[model samples]
Target: MRHVVAAVAGLIFALGLGISGMTDPGKVIGFLDVGGAWEPALAFVMGGAVVVYALAYRLIVRRPRPVVEVKFSLPTAKKVTTSLVVGSALFGIGWGLGGYCPGPALTSVVSGSWEVGLFVVTMLAGMGLHQVWERLSARGSAAAAPAPAAPLAEGPLKGVDA
Candidate 1:
């Protein structure tokens, strides 16, 4: 039931992207291109989305639990670190370069565009690389962690240094 709802929601979102011209790279790039033939349609779309989300969140978040989920898992982290800043910058740069953010790019995949395929592949690769980096970081931190003191010997060897 949850899967069905999620699938339906995703389909609706994709349809919205397509209908709003978000799935078009040219339109997105044009929107980004300030001081040129800059488009304002996406800006209006985003503003409308934000307003809707704000209203929906204000109402929905008051509920004790979600309809499908046990509870809402909101982000706990509040501190902004260097990694966060760098990752955001990278994401923005990638979006500007490719003229397609993750949502739109994923939605555009069904269009059979080779550029979209390449973008998806590289995006997946970047995600995989981040996973590898995270694993290595975890291992390194584990290795660097100090070990606990060993317990004393029992019985006859309790007093013995060796």
Candidate 2:
């Protein structure tokens, strides 16, 4: 079943994170430090991940569709806007300060670290705030916008009977 496969894959991923020392906040923080007592092991971990992802993406693209989906749902947005810049800046700031992104943060939660807990709480709050902002912006835009009239078509087929 899909659930079984997903669970097994998640367990494997968690094990990988554990074995790679990615679940340790100290290790991650050391890597980020870059000046004092810097650890370079995280670079190796990142390299391995990049290699795996490159190979996996190539293999997946060769397939007509994924095993569990009719088609791949890829992001269509390509614009570089204010939202993207601000979001990325916030994410970088959080990662730099906490030494843990979502994946590693969740994994390190098992260590009973208060920093990880606080990071997760703030992360959740940020997500909630973004949702609220999005809803309010949409409502404001809708209220300010005017309805469009039907277009008058031209050409040979325009006035032809259906």
Candidate 3:
């Protein structure tokens, strides 16, 4: 049931992206271009999306649990950490360079665009690399962690009350 809901939601989202021209790399690039022939149409689309999301979020969060899920999945982190900053920066850079973020890129895959296909491939590779890097870092941190102190050999207190 959850899977069906997820699939339906994804289908709707993909249709929205396609209908809004968000799946077009050229349109995205044009929107990102601030100096030369900047296209502002996407801005309106984004603003509308934000407004809808804000309202929907408020309404949905008022419920104790989501319609499909037992609990609403929300971000618990409040402080802006270095990882967040770095990840956001990287995402911005990738979006600017490739002119296609993950959502639109995935939606556009059916269009049979080589650029979109390449972007998806590289994005997957980057995700895999990140997983490998995190695993290696976790192992390194675990190895660097201090070991627990060994107990002292049986002392006089062992045979006598303190």
Candidate 4:
């Protein structure tokens, strides 16, 4: 049931991308061009998405758990770290250079363009490299961790053994 629903939702999303000309590199690049041959059409699509997400996020964050999850696993990180800044810059550079971020890149794949294929391949490689780097970094940090302390003495179940 979930798979079917997911497929339907993905189809709808892909259709939206196609209809909005997101699958076309020209359209995307035009939007980014700004001072030169700028197209503001995609901005409306993005604006609509932002509005929808803002409303949905406001409602969802109030809930203790999501309908399909045991608990909310939201990001707890609050600080703007170096990795975040570098990753964001890379993302923006890729989007500007290729005119196809991940979503549009995947949607554009059906067109059988070799350039898009190459972009997706490199994107996957970049993700894999990041995963490897993260694991290595974590291992180095975890190696320096002190021995585990005793379990919590105070919480929702204070003094209660689990």
Which candidate has the highest TM-score of all?
A: 3
lDDT by residue (tens digit), candidate 3, 1-162:
999998999999899888898888889999999999999899887898999999999998999998878997675545665766798799999998888988999998888988889999999999899767766765666577644221122221222221
Candidate 2: where is the Cα deviation over 4 Å? 146-162
Q: Write the per-residue lDDT of candidate 4 for residues 1-162, one digit (tens) a residue.
A: 657777988999899888888888889999999989889889998888899989999999899886666786665545666766888899899899999988888988888989999999999998899767766755665566543221121122221221
RMSD of 4: 7.4
Residue by residue across 1-56, what tens digits does model 2's lDDT show?
77888899878877878888887778888988888989999888889988998999
Q: After superposition, how far is residue 162 of candidate 3 from its true place, in Å?
A: 56
Each candidate: what lDDT? 0.79, 0.73, 0.79, 0.78
Model 1, residue 61: C-alpha shift (Å): 0.9
lDDT of candidate 3 at residue 99, scale 0 to 100: 86
Which lDDT tens digits does candidate 1 get at residues 1-162? 889998999999888888888988889889988889888789977887899989999999999999989998675445665767888899888887989988889998888889999999999999899767766765666577644221211222321221
* Each prediction's TM-score versus the true structure: 0.84, 0.78, 0.85, 0.78
Candidate order by TM-score, decreasing, is 3, 1, 2, 4
Q: What range of 10 consecutive residues in model 3 has the weakest lDDT sum?
A: 148-157
TM-score of the candidate numbered 4?
0.78
lDDT-better candidate, 2 vs 3: 3
